[model samples]
Target: MKAEGLKIILSGPSGSGKGTIVRELIKKEHFILSVSATTRLPRQGEQDGVHYFFKTKEEFETMIKDDELLEYAQFCDNYYGTPKTFIEESVKNGKDVILEIEVQGALQVKAIYPEALFVFVMPPTLTELENRLVGRNTETPAVIAQRLARAKEEVAFYKEYDYVVINDSLEEAICDIETIVAAEKLRSSRFKQEIEKVWNA
Candidate 1:
């Protein structure tokens, strides 16, 4: 019997390099990065299904009311959520689905999918995190300050996750996540059918 794929919830603060790690993981692993649905309008050159499943505020609210969203959160006056059907179908078909979301939404998923693996990425130091934010040169000084303060608050939630990977080295961080996925695939709970077949034989 084939083992079912794992549902992985990967989350981190703004400057933790989680996005970069996810991109690398996709290249090396048989994983599908879940596309999120958002109420925000598409920016220039953004596609509906590829970038985000764009929806009107009314439609998004209806989904929430109907329990179609696995997890949803409001950010910058816009609703962003994981559609339940896509993830359920992908995992059932033996595809490891990675949901890269913010900590708030990740915790919401934890409540609904307790069996899912939750991994939190962290920077080596808060100062380093600040530096990375500053290095971007995209955000203003006020925005960077806000992000740094939020990063400190997010650090406290590390204890809530099953695994915390300190992303001091990008290569090392990716390796650690890959290791986690490989070990999780071998977990006894994930091989119930194989175990039963051998025992019955």
Candidate 2:
């Protein structure tokens, strides 16, 4: 019997390189990156249903009312959420769906799908995290400071995750996650049916 694909929740603070990690992971076979839906206007070159399933505030609210989202959060007056149907369909077809989300939304997914694998990515040190944020050069000093403070708060939640990967080296971090996925697929509970088939054979 073919085993179903795992639902994976990948989360980290703003500067932890989780986005880069997810991009690399999706390059491998059978891994799909779950796209999110949002009420925010599409930026230049962003295509609807590709970058995001762009929606109006009223349309987004209807999704929330209908419980079509696995998890949703409001940011800067816009709602961002993972559509439950996409993840469900992907996993059913044996594609491991990776959801790169905030810590809060990740916890919400955990509550709904406790069987999912949860991983928290982190920088080697708090100082290094701050450095990465500043390296972007996109935000002002005050905004950088705010992100640093938020990082401290978010890092504290690492203990809630099943595994933690330190993103000091991008290649090594990617390898570590791949190893985690390989090991998770071998968990005895996941192979129970196969084991029984062999035993009966």
Report, for every candidate in turn, its global Cα lDDT versus the true structure. 0.90, 0.92
Each model's TM-score? Answer: 0.86, 0.86
Please list the residue runs of candidate 1 whose C-alpha ends up more than 4 Å from where it truly belongs after superposition: 39-48, 54-62, 73-79
Worst 10 residues of 2 by lDDT: 101-110
Q: What lDDT is reached at residue 133 by model 1? A: 94
Q: Which portions of model 2 show Cα errors greater than 4 Å?
A: 39-48, 54-62, 74-79, 197-201
Question: Which lDDT tens digits does candidate 2 get at residues 1-201?
Answer: 677888999999999999999999999998899989999999999999778999999999999999999888899999998899888989989999998878987887889999999999999999999889989999999999999999989988998899999999999999999899889888889989788889988
Model 1 misses residue 50 by how many Å?
Answer: 2.9
Cα deviation of 111 in candidate 2 (Å)? 0.6
Q: Residue 97 of model 1: what lDDT?
A: 90
Instruction: Compose the digit string of candidate 1's lDDT tens values, residues 1-201.
Output: 677778999999998999999998878557889989999999999998878999999999999999999977899999998899888888899888999978887788888999999999999998899899999999999999999889888889988789999999999999999899889888888888788889998
